[model samples]
Target chain A: MTSVLEIRNLHVSVADKPILKGVNLLVKQGEVHALMGPNGTGKSTLAYTLMGHPLYVVTGGQVIFKGVDLLELAPDERSRLGLFLAFQYPVAIPGVSVANFLRTALNARRRAANPADKGIPIPEFRKLLKAKMDMLQVSHDFAGRYLNDGFSGGEKKRAEILQMATLDPEIAVLDETDSGLDIDALRIVAEGVNKLAGPNMGALVITHYQRILNYIKPNVVHIMLGGQIVESGEADLALHLEERGYDWVREKYQEKAEA
Target chain B: MSEQVAELEKLSEYKYGFSDNVHYAYQSQRGLNAGVVRTLSGMKGEPQWMLDFRLKALDIFNKKPMPTWGGKISLDLDEITYYTRPSEKTESSWDDVPADIKNTFDKLGIPEAERKFLAGVGAQYESEMVYHSVQKHLEELGVIFLSSDDGLRQYPELFREHFGKVVPPTDNKFAACNSAVWSGGSFVYVPKGVHVEMPLQAYFRLNAEGTGQFERTLIIVDEGAQVHYVEGCTAPTYSRDSFHSGVIEIIVKKGARCRYTTIQNWSTNVYNLVTQRAVVHEGATMEWVDANLGSQLTMKYPSCYLVGEGAHGEILSMAFAGPGQHQDTGGKVVHGAPNTTSKITSKSISRAGGRTSYRGLLKVYKGATGSKSSVVCDALLIDDKSRSDTYPVIEIDENEVTIGHEASVSKVGEEQLFYLMSRGIPKDQAEGLVVAGFIEPLVKELPMEYAVELNRLVQLQMEGSVG
Candidate 1:
């Protein structure tokens, strides 16, 4: 059976101001969807609401993943239910190594799945982490450094991807992961996403620029404006927006609202 | 219900709340006066000069008034049993120790630690030493490790020369109290050019209710010698508050180095007031590692006096304050000679309405040119109800001295918590990880087993803090 995430009439507010208004979308396993729009258009808001950020209040919405209500759960519970958000600005946790954090996260997931389950043995966990790091082309020394503490832009993005690979979430929402990256870093991150998306997982690639869409080809493309997704089309729609900027989409949505 | 029974019921959650049923060979009456001091001195069969010293100390203790700073104190001096002798003699072999007392140390893991790494071990129960031993090789190197009473009885002249030189009875009221009724603490002397690799450990336990334990520890590191001394303390919980006032004096000779580490985890019904200081000679170094985790109220400031040229001192202090606990601890460094240097680092955590304060002083004398000092204090508050404070004083009379001080107070931010929890960690465990990171710098300096134990204790303290 294929897993599905259904977002219907979702409304979100931040600090008493609405950011996401009546948004609707559907994502299924083995499919990649791209969400593109101008800045401040509720792209990241939708991602944060999907991951249950406490600051993003869900005033009205129903987010069901695998037939379970995601909005009714805590952030940790949402994560344990195979929902992940690659944060735009990852926070640094000093004195916590990447290997240690990953192992703790894995153990938490295991214990949640079965109450009587002892955590992964140290040797086995080490082997698993090494395998994942090797698969992602990450240096072994990266595991020893403190989690994102003094990391550069490219390093932080790479660390995020490394975490995504280690966690193996079923549905990942990439919220502007390409914002602070150079060209080389952008290609590497896009390749990491491409490699992770398969029949076992689905992805919602949220971005502002069309350059990343060129690398990780999305099966369906959606344009968001004014707290609502305004356009849905085939892959060529991103190319159309790249040729002409969001000015045309703004005008089009303006005419539609007036009518 | 009686007060004692009610206190025992409240101590069910404490790990070391189990008390022994052994009979004390001798116990002083519940009071402190001239007669009590005389009886304590007479019981030890001390020299006349020592008796005179105790009598003078009693006068000073009576004259000094109670302090009105740091944590609050509600102790009644007239209601405390000042002296208790659990066994008649200190046993050199573990098998010779009384069964119940040995069982207590066994549960505390003293013998296992001794067999694994410690060069010497001293177990003090109530007011007397019950078990004492040193590795045969260290004993062959002219190293003297024994109880304070045995040190006086066997090596009187050496003990008399350096007993109270570092910290005298006139220093404070608690120091004077310890001076009058001091008993059962470690006495160590490392000869010139001899370096003992393993640490010498002392474990102090208070068993009786409404009693006081005043242990006097004196260590002397001779020229070019090196040693590390560690002491850990814990007591059973009771409704009636107990009092613990100890005085530790150390001397580091020319080119010698000494490190003293203490892990204090008394029960919540105890007031722990201790005075520990060391004097460093020319080209010598001294370090103090102090970790305070328990007790209703604790006021301790370990100090180092750099009295000779080219001396150095370092202090690393850590404190954890849980519900109804107040930890007032820091370090002091005094530079009396030229070309001296010192450093102090302190870290504290407060949770569940507990409070912690860092009170420190750095002083450089008039002629102590080219001296340098640095102090840093960092505190973490786990919730809105917790509290932390810092008071640092620096006095530099010399124009050519260098000084630096930095302090920070931070709460566990919601963003940090959210970031950790979003990765599937529960709220309480997430808070625990952040706290472990905040105190990582100090915890890394502890030994392997102690580092593990400290982390475990911090985890245990964080369990019920989150809703």
Candidate 2:
């Protein structure tokens, strides 16, 4: 059975100002979707709202994932249900090693799935971490570093992808993961995401550029403007938007409102 | 009420609140006087000179005024019972100890820790040491480990030579109080060139109500010797506040090294004011690792007097202040000799309307050229109602000295919390992890067992902190 995320008329407000105004979209397992928009177009807001950030208050919305309303769950509960958000600016947690944090997160998910589960054994966890690090081309020493503390921009982005690979979420939301990376770092991170996105996993790639879309091919493309997804089409639509930009879309929406 | 406040209240419950019904061999009359001091010394069978010393200390206690700075003190010194001895004499074997006293120590895991890693153990109840033991090999190595009273009687010459040399009775009001009514603390003497690989631990338990615990500890590490000493304290809860004022003095001889670690978790109804200082000789080192967790109010600053050239001192201090608690703690270092070095690092956490302050002092006297010192204080406030402060005093008369001080105050950021929680950790655990990370540097300095226990205690304090 395939998993589906149905976001219908989602309205989210931050500090009494609406950022996501009745946005609607659908993503399914085994498919990669690209969400393209300019700055302040609610692309990040939609991503944060999907992951249940406390600051993004839902004024009106229904985000149904696997037939359950995602809006009613806590962030941890959403994560236990296999939802993940690769933050654009991942915060630093000083003195917490990446391996320790991953193990804790993995144990939390495991205990939620089965209350009797103790935790991943140390040797087993080491093996699993080594395998995932190898696949992502991340150095073994990366696991020993404090999570994102004093990390460079590229290291932080790669850390996010490494986390995504280890968690293996069913529906992953990559929110501007390519923003801070250099070309080499971007290819490494993009390739990591590609390796993790499989038949059992789905991804919503949110970005403002078409450069990352070249590496991680998306089957469906959606363009967001002024707090809503106004246009969506095949993967070629991202190429079209790259050439024409959002000016034409803004003009079309203004014409519709005036009529 | 908000869920956060409710959770904080729930987490503030004291786990070591249970009391035991023990038959005290002798209990002193409530309130303090010169007669009480005389009777305490007489009961200990101390010599004439020691009695005269106590009398002088009692006079100083009466003349000195209460301190006007740091946390507010509501202690009614006149109403406190100054002495309560649970046993007639210290027991060398655990089985010889009274069942009730042994059970109390058992509950606190004193014996278990001794068997696991400690080279010696001292279990104190009220104002007397009830159980004491040292490993056979350590005893064979000419190490002197005994109760302070026994040290006075058995090693009189050595005890008299070093007793008040480091911390005289006139050091502070509390030090005077402790000198006048001191009892039950450990006396350790490591001979020349001998190194004790394992730690010697002392656990103090205050089971009675409205009583004062004055344990005066003295340690002397001879030339080229080394040892590590750890002390832990806890008390049963009571409506009226108890008092604990201890004075610990150590002398690290030339080329010797000594470490003193303290994990103080007294009941919330206790006033803990302790004065600890060490005199480091040439080429010697002294370290103080102090962690303060539970108390109504605490004002303690462990100090090191670097009186010899090339001596070194280090202090790692941590404090946790919960509801209705105030912890004013830090360290002090005096560079009195040339080329001396010192470092003081302090970490404090305040939650649920609690308050913590880091008050430290670093002083370099004239002619103490090339001395280097740095002080760092970091405080974490868990809630808006909690409070933290840093008071760092640096006085340097030497123009050639180097000094640096850094202080930071941080709250658990919402972004960090969201990041962790979004990875499947719950809110409270996420906060606990962040706090654990905040103190990781100091925790790593502790022994494995102590580091683990400190982390567990921090987690317990963080429960329901986020709602």
Instruction: Kindly list the per-residue Cα lDDT of model 2 for residues B124-219, writing each as its tens digit.
Output: 333333322344656888988777888899999999999988989998899998898898787899999999998876642221111237888999
TM-score of 1: 0.89
**TM-score for every candidate vs. truth?**
0.89, 0.89
The residue pairs in collision within model 2 are: none
Per-residue alpha-carbon lDDT of model 1 for A1-259, expressed as tens digits?
8889999999899999988888999999888999999888899999988987889999997999999999999888888888788889998888788988888888889999998988999999888888877877788999988888999988898888888888888898998999989999999899999899999889999999999997999999999988888999999999999999999999989953332
Candidate 1 Cα outliers beyond 4 Å, as residue runs: A255-259, B1-24, B88-134, B204-212, B233-241, B465-467
Worst 10 residues of 1 chain B by lDDT: B113-122
**C-alpha positional error of residue A28 in candidate 2 after TM-score superposition, expressed in Å:** 0.9
Task: Give the clashing pairs for model 1.
Answer: none
Q: Candidate 1 on B1-467: residue-level lDDT in tens?
A: 44433443343224334442323366566667889899989988999888888888889999899987878987667667677653522212433222333343344455453321111112333333332234465688888887788889999999999998888888899899899988878789999989988777664222211122687889999999999988773322122226789899999999999999988766566789999999999999999999998788899999999999999999999998988899999999999999999999999999999999999999999999999999999999999999999989898899999999999999988888888888888888888888888887877877777787777667766885211
How many clashing residue pairs are found in candidate 1?
0
